[model samples]
Target: MNYKTFLINLDRSPQRLADAKKQLDALDMSFERVSAADGSQLTPEERACFDKNTAQKRYHYDLTWGEVGCYLSHLKCWQKIVDEKLDYAIILEDDLHLQDDFNKVPELLEQLKTPWSFIKLGNPFKPRKETPVETLARFNLVRYDKAPSGTCAQVVSYQGAKALLAARSLFFRPVDVDLQWQWEVPIKILGLTPYVAGHNLSFDSDIQQIDQRKNKAKRSGVRLREQLRFFYHSKLRGE
Candidate 1:
């Protein structure tokens, strides 16, 4: 279908913009650059809300200002989609490496059997259930047992945008986590395996200067708690 594309880019990162443009140009794809909000630019009120709304504080050990800014940037895109009344939009971060035939994704979307609120284009590490996939022409689509992480590339429908906006109005978790906890929001989320678009590993993260690793020792307790919660919600309750 005739969908609009938005690339989340920061003004300070010219190299990322250049690289994104080069890839899109190669595929003859068009997109509009949605200027990303820098974490350092968060106003006093935004910062206060960021501090107050954090849901996973136990696991969210030291979320930097940049991470909050990144979350807000994605929120801005979702708002744009809802405000514009678009059927759906393709959302991409600046660090994508599109597959050779990535340009044909629009055609793939046209053939979807069911209307989807969210469709993840990039491959995830390991979706929760290891369920069978409903094969499309050139890709596999599955409603993962767990909401997949990574917002590298995806398509979000107007309803999905609205659902997400409403779900996180009080706003506490990371953007990816906000979307991943599907039971909290109740949106239709689908994942595409053999990713049509993936991230370029060479590009460093705008949110982190160094490797952002969580302390495994500290994470064990929260991780176990979350695992049980996921099990109860996803399998036991069959939600």
Candidate 2:
């Protein structure tokens, strides 16, 4: 394949990176490891991009610093794809377990008849609706009604990379959640059935922050409002 592959890895998480590397080696696939942005190490200027008021308005809650950093990490991958003039690139988070047929990616991608902004290779959660587009040798390409919840593995087109980068400049939620807002992004996102990869079952997530606010005492009215907004986004908006 002419496309490049990038694996996001934080410097502090060398063990995770090493584990991912071994899997890639087993698949005989080469990739460049991009240093992930650590939320705790953001500078003042970078931190300013995460506007609290906007985040609260969009998500009905403030986005965690780790979420901001995770969003930035994916944005960086998009920027690199654009700046390097690559046609498209497969992006992988450093905690995926590759399926045996993962090596057939290059060949299978050639079967795509339509242009796609993003093609999710791993689906941690199945979408409510999926229309089969093409039946490849080992997997079927499907157009999904909603974005899946993981950024763990996906192939991103150059145009999709640019669009996502521009749209997410002032992101208001976690990277995966933000992706679910397709109305805001305006791009074609596809999925591969019987996913090529999935999250490593043995590994715990490092990027997602646990919410501590659930234990706090809050007014019923405020709590009710948050639930309504969530329902609007997740159900009404189909995010």
Instruction: Single out the weakest 10-residue window by summed lDDT for candidate 2.
Output: 209-218
What C-alpha lDDT do the candidate models reach, one value each? 0.76, 0.79
Which residue runs of candidate 2 sit more than 4 Å off their true CA positions?
209-239
CA-only RMSD, every prediction: 2.7, 3.3
lDDT of 1 by residue, 100-156 (tens): 877877887787787688988885345555343577765777777666677889999
- Candidate 1 vs. true structure, TM-score: 0.88
Which residue pairs show collisions in model 1?
A: 53-172
Model 2: lDDT equals: 0.79
Identify the leading candidate in terms of TM-score. 1
